[model samples]
Target: MLLLFVHSKAQTVTGRIVDSEKQSVVMATIALQTLDSINICATTADADGRFVLTADSIPLPFRLIVSSIGYETVMPECASYAVGDVVLATKTNVLGDVVVKSKRPILNVQGDRIVADASSIIKGRIVTCAFDVAKYVPGILCKNDNELSLAGTMSTTVLVNGKVWNGGSVLEYLKTLPAEKVSKVELLYNASPDMHVTGAVINVVLKDNKGRELTGQVKSSYYNNHHNTFQESGSLFYTTPKWSLYSMYTFADAKSISRSQYLSHHTVGNQVYDIDVDARTHSSSLTHAVYTNATYNVSDKSNVSLSYNASFSPKSDTKGRTTNSYFSNSNYTTSGNSYMHNLHLAYVLKQLRLDANYMSYSNDGTQDMNYEKYENPTAYSYWRKQTSDRFNFSADWGFPLWKTARFSLGATYAYSKTGNRQK
Candidate 1:
C-alpha cells in the first residue's frame, strides 16, 4: 500500500511500444529522460504489447522515438503543423489534437458571437459609431443614408445595455456611446423573434464590470479641419465574491467639436429667367453626452440593472447670399439644441428575461433663410418631445434551425406618445 501511494503521486508513462505498423514490438528500448540530468528511466515492452514505467522528476518536453524493421519514422507535430505544445509535441513532427492551445485567430474563438477590440483611429481604425464598428465584421455594410445593413438587408434592430432605443436608426444612439465602452457586438442572425427583428439584428454588448472591480479611460483628438473633440469615462464594480451582493457602475462624457462649409448658389425671382447668386457660408455644431448604468446581481443566476442616457447637440450657423435679380444680398445667424434619454430596469434568471424601459426624447432646431421669400424670416424653429414605456419578457426554448445550429425566440410590447411642446 505504501509503494502504491508513492506510485500514484509520481507521473507515470503507460502505453504500448509498437512498430510502424502498430504491431507490438517486445524488447524494444523505451527511454524516459528527466531534465535533472542524473535521473533517467527505461523499460521493455511486454509480450502482451503493454508496458508501465514510473519516473521521478521528469522534465517537460518528454519525447518518445520508436524505430524498428522496414517502416517509415513519423513525428506527430512538426513546424509544418504548428503544434507547439511541449507536453504533447516535444520532438520532431509530433502532433496531438487532444491537447489544448492558444493561437492566432482565423476567426472568433469563443465568448458570445464575436469579439472586437478598439485600435487607435489614427492607425486607420475608424470607430465613429455602430455603423463604423459593424463595418469591421463580414456581411455588414453601411448604406448611403448612414444606416446599417446586414446580409443584403437594411434596418438592423439594436439593443444597448439590454434596452431598445428604437429610434428607427441607431446611428444616433451609437454616436452617443463610445466605442471603447463596448466589449462585444453580437450579430443576431435570422432572428425569428418580433421584439428584436427590424430587418436584421444587432446587440451591442457593453464592457461588464462584475469581475473587473474598476476600469475606464479618457481621450481627446484634433482634426485638420479646425475641429476638436474630447471624452472622459470610468467604471466601478464589485462582484458577489465570497459574499452575495453584486454592483457595477459605468459613466461616460463626450463633447464633439465639428465644423463644416455650407456653400450654395441660389435663384429666387418673380421673372422665370432672372436668377439670384450666392457666396460663402459656414456652420459649426457641438454635442455633449452623458450615459450611466447600474447593475445588481441578486444571486448566482439572477440580476437586475438600471441605466440612463442623456445627450444634447447645439448647432450654430452663419450665412450670406446674393441674388443677381436687382443684385440683392442678406445675412442671418442662429443656434439650436436637443436632448434624449432612456431609463430601464431588468431581471435575468436562467433562460428567462424580463425588463421595463422608459424613454424621453426632445429636440429643438432652427434655420434662418435670409432671402426674398419670407416677409419676416425669424429663424425656422421647431421643438418636439416624446415618451415611451415598454415591457419585455422572453424565455429560451431549443429548436433546431439546422443540424448544427439552434433557434431562440422572444417577444415584447411597447406604449408610446409624441407631442409638440413648443412651436
Candidate 2:
C-alpha cells in the first residue's frame, strides 16, 4: 500500500494604508472579501498603518476592501498579488442648506463630581483661550474675564491637573492655555479634605502629550471698539520620556474710553435744586506676561515639577474729566507700574503629594488732580505704593480604605505679609 500526503502553505496578505498626502492612516479597517461582496477575513491597521491578513487558503482573484473614518471606501481586485501601499482618498459631501439643531446635555454626574466635556462645549463655539472654556462650564460664571464664581459662591479656586496655581494673575495663566489642550473640566462642589480647599473648585484636566516630542503655537488678535487693542502670544512645549517643559509669553497694548452721566435732585429748607454731572475716562496700558513649567518623571508612579509665572505692566495711564452743573470742573490723571512673580515646586507620587509656593507682588502709582471751584485754580498730587509677599506649603496622602471608599489626610501652612505707603 502506498500513502500520499499533500502539503499546502497558508496565504498571507499584507499592506500599508496612507492618505493622499502620504500620512499614515492609523486604525483603518482592512478586510478581505469574495467576488460576491461577502466578507472573508478582517484586520486593522497599526500605528504605522500596516496590516496583515492570513488564511489557510485565499480564493483566487479575491477582493480587498479598505475603509476609514473621514475617508472614502476603496476596494481593489487582487489576483496572485501582494498589496504594497494602499492610498485612500478623503471623503467630502456637499448638501443644500439644512437646519438640524440639537442640544447636548450640559452637565453629567461622574462619581463624586460634575464633569463637562470641553470639546463638546467648544464645538460650534468660538473659544480663543482656556478662560473662554470656563464660560461654557455649567454653574460657573466668568465676569470681566478675570473673576470666576460657581453657583453664587465667590470663593472659587481653579486648579490644573490637581495642582494649585499660585501663578501671578490666574487670568494670565488661563490666557496662556489653549482651548484645544483642555480635555475636560471637573467641578468639585464639596472638595475632599486632602485638597486643602474650602470652596468650590474648577479643575482643568489638560490632554496628555505622551508620544509628542515638540509642539508650539502662536496667536495674535486686534480689535477696535472706540480704541485700538492688540495682543500677541506664543507658547512652546517639549517632551521626552522623562522630561517635559512648557513656556508661554504674552504682550498686550490696549486703549479704552468710557463715558458716564449722573443726575440728582435735592431739596433742603424748602429749596429745590437740580444737578447734573458728566464724566469721561480714557485709559491705556502695556503689559507683558511670562509663564513656564518643567516636569521630570522620577519613576512610573512619581514625578516632580517646578513652575514660574510673572506679569509686568510697565506703563499704564488713565485720565478722567468731570463737569457739574454747579459751575465746577475737575480733571485727574493717574500713572502706575505693577509687577508680580510666583514660583512653585511640587512632588507627586501615586499616593502622596507635596507642594510649595512663593509669590511677590508690587504696585506703585502717582495721581494728579486739577479742579476749578468758584473760578479758583487748585492742584493736588499724590503717590501711593503697595507690596505683598506670600508663601504656602502643603502635603497630602491618600489610600484606598475599601472598594468604594478612600481615606485621605493632608496639612497646609501659609504666611503672608503686605505693606502700603501713601504720600
Candidate 3:
C-alpha cells in the first residue's frame, strides 16, 4: 500500500523547461500529481520558461509531467522544491510521405462546413470588400460580377454573419461589405433548416465590434479602349454595442464599339445567290446603385435587421448600321432606362429566423429601324414598357439532433406579378 505524507509547512515548487538546444519552451504545460494519479497542481511556463506553483500540503514523491507543442513529453526525476530544469526533445518528422502545417491555418474544418479565415488573407493587400477576398478561397468561383459558383457547380446563395443578404445581387452585396469587418467565410455544404437554403451556402461572418466605431472606403477607376469607361464606389459603416449601420454606393459609365460580319449562300431552282453583310454598333450606358442596412441586437441570442437597395440604369443606348452585298442598307437605334428596388427585413432568435422581402423592377425602351433597297425605303418603330413586383416570406428553425447529425425544418412563401406593354 502507498501512502502520501503531508507536511505542515507549505512550500513553492519552481522550475524552467527548455529543449535540448537550451531554447526556452514558452507555454509548456506542467502538472503535479499524487501517487494515486490524481492531479493536485498545474501550471504553465511563461515566456522565459519559468514557472512557480505553490501547494498547501506537500505530497512526498510527487509525480511531475511536462509537455509542450512540437516536443516530446518529459517526466522529471523529482518534484521537490529543489527540482532542477526539465528538458524536452524536439519531435522529429521522419514520415517521408507528406506533411502540412501552418502557424495560422487559413481554413478550418467544422463538420459539414469549412471556414476560411478572411482577415488573415486580407491584410497587407488592397482588398476592400469580400469580393476581393473570395478569389483566395478554394472551391469558390467568381463566375462574373453578379454570380458566385461553388465547386464549378450552380450558383449559391450568400449570407452575412448568419443572415441572408437580400439587399441586391450576390456580387453587389459582396462588394459593399468591407473585408476588414469579416472574421471568417464559412462554406456550408449542408445547410440547416433555419438557414432556408436549397443547396450549398457561403456564409460571411463579421467581426463583433464592442464599442461605437466607424469605418468606410472609397475607390474609382478609369479605362480606355475603343471607348472610355469610368467607375466610382464607396462604403460606410458605423457600429455600437447595440446597433450597426452600413451603406454603400456605386456609379459607372461605359462606352464601346463592336464590329461583326455575316455571310450566307442560297440556291433556288438551279440559281445561286451569295450575300455578305458587315455591321458596326456603338453603345453607351450609365449605372448607379446604392444599398443600406441597419441591424439591432435585441439580446444576446436575438437580433433584427432591415435593408434597402436601389439600382438605376438611366441611359443605355445603341446605334448600328449594316451594309449588304445585294439587298439593302439598314440602320437601327435602341435606347432603354431601367431601375430596381428591394426591401428586406429579418428577425433572428437563436436557431429560428423569420424573413420578409419585397422587390420591384421597371423598364422603358424604344427601338427604330430604317432600310433602303432599290429606290424603296422602309421604316419601323417599336416601344416597350414593363414592370414587375415580387414578395417572399419564410420561417426556419435548426438545431442539433445527434452527435453527427442535425435537424432542420422551414416553411416559405413567394408571390410575383408582371405587366408588359408594347407598340
Candidate 4:
C-alpha cells in the first residue's frame, strides 16, 4: 500500500493601519475570520502600525476585521491575499448634559521633550496657518512679526520633522504650511546635542499621507487697516507608495500708513525751548513666494528629500514727511526690490541623518532725501545694493543607551559671505 499526503502552503496577510488623519494607529487589533464568522487567525499592529497574519491551508475566502479603541471597526473581504492600508475613522458619541469636572491635559511630557496635541490646540478656534497655531503653543511667545522666543530667550530654532529649516524666514515658511497638516508639536527647552542647536527648539511634525493620493487647499485673506491688503495662497500634495511631492505658492500685496508726533524740550546756555515734530510714513510692497519639496523612500528605514524655496518682492516703496515748530521740514522717498532663494537636501537612515543647505539673497534700492532749515534747502540721494550667500551642512546620530537615557552625536559646518555697496 502506497500513501501520498498533500499539504497547502500557508497564506499570509500584511497591511498597515492608520486613522482618518493619516497618523499611525499603533496596537490595533487585526483578526482573520471565515465566511461563517469563525476566527482563523489574529494579530496586533506593531509600533509602526503594520500587521501580518498567517494561516496554514487557509480557506478559499476570508475577511479581515480591524478594530481599535476610539475608532470605528472595519471589516474588509479578501479573496486570496490581503495587502494594503486600512483607515479607521474616529468614533463620536453624543451625550446629554454630561459635565465633567476633570479634563485631559493638552501638554504632556515625552522623554526630554514636551508634546502638545495640535488638534486640541486648534479645536473650536479659527486657525488658518501653522504660524497661527504656533502662537497658541504653551510657553512660546511671538516677539515680533518674524521672531519667536521661549522663556525670554531670543535664540530659538524651528524644525520640521526633526530637520532644520533653512528656507528663508521661518515665519514665511510657517505661513505657507496649513494648520491641518500638523500632527503634533514638540518643544525642547534645553535642546539635545544631536539637534545641533544651542538654544530652545520647536519641532513641527506633519501627518503622513499614505492612503490618500491627492490633496490640496486654497486660502485667501483681505485686510483693511491704514490701507487695503490682500493675500492668496494655495498648496498641493501628491503621494504614492514610495514617493511624495508637495508645493505651495503665495502672493501678497500690502500697503501701510503710520503717523507719529514727538515733543521735546531743549536748553542751550540756560535758555529753554520747546519743540514739536510730526511725521507720517507710507509703505507698500508686492511679493511672490513659492516652495516645493520632493521625497523618495529608498526603504522602510531610509529616505531622501529635496526642497526649494524662493521669495521675490518686485515693488517696495516708502515715503515719509516730517515738520517741526523750529521751521524745519524734510521729505524722503525709498524704493527697492529684494529676492531670496534657498535649496536644501537631506538623507535619513533610521536614527542617523545628514543635511545640506544653501541660501542666497539680494537687495537693490535707492533713497532720496530733502531737508530745509530756516528756508535753507539741501538735497541728498544714495543708491544701495546688498547680497548674501550662505551654505550649511550637518550630520546627526542618536540612539538609545538604556531604558531611560539616550546618547547623541552630531557635527555642523556653515559658511557665509555678504557684500553691501552704498553711493
Give lDDT tens digits, candidate 4, residues 139-159: 455665566654333467888
Worst 10 residues of 1 by lDDT: 80-89
TM-score of each: 0.50, 0.70, 0.70, 0.71
Q: Residues 1-423, candidate 3, lDDT per residue (tens digit)?
A: 999997676678888888898988776656565655544555567788887766676577776767554566665646467666888787666668865321222554454566677876575567778877764454455664546654422447777767665434667667777787878887664465567666667788888768898988887888775899998988899999999999989998999998999999989889988989999999999999899889999998898999998999999999999999989999999999999999999999998889999999999999999998768999999999999999999988888888656878889999999999999
lDDT of each residue in 1-423, candidate 2, tens digit only: 999999889789888989899888776656576686544555567788888877767887888767654576677888765788899887655557754332332444444456678887788778877878866664566787777765434377887887776645666667767788788887765566766776567888887656657767788979786899999989887888788899999999999999999999999999988999999999999999999999898987899999999999999999999999976799999999999999999999999999999999999999999888876889999999999999999999989877636888888999999999999
Candidate 1: segments with Cα more than 4 A from true spot: 1-135, 141-151, 158-163, 166-184, 206-212, 224-276, 314-330, 365-368, 372-411, 421-423
Off by more than 4 A, model 2: 1-110, 117-134, 137-155
**Whole-model lDDT for model 4 versus the true structure?**
0.78
> For residues 1-423, what per-residue lDDT tens digits would candidate 1 score against the true structure?
355434435656666655434566543333343322221344434574455545554556554433221222222312211222112112233367564322211123122132333332112455644445544543344566355644323355666644566322345445544555566655443333534443346666665444543333343444333434343333232334322222222232332333333344455575344343545444565555555556776676666776666565645344444443444455555456666666666777755677666666666555455545446543343443433344444443335667535567666666767666555
| Deviation in Å, model 2, residue 189 alpha carbon | 1.4
Ranking by TM-score: 4, 2, 3, 1
**lDDT by candidate, in order shown:** 0.45, 0.79, 0.76, 0.78
> lDDT of model 4 at residue 375?
61
Clashing pairs in 4: none
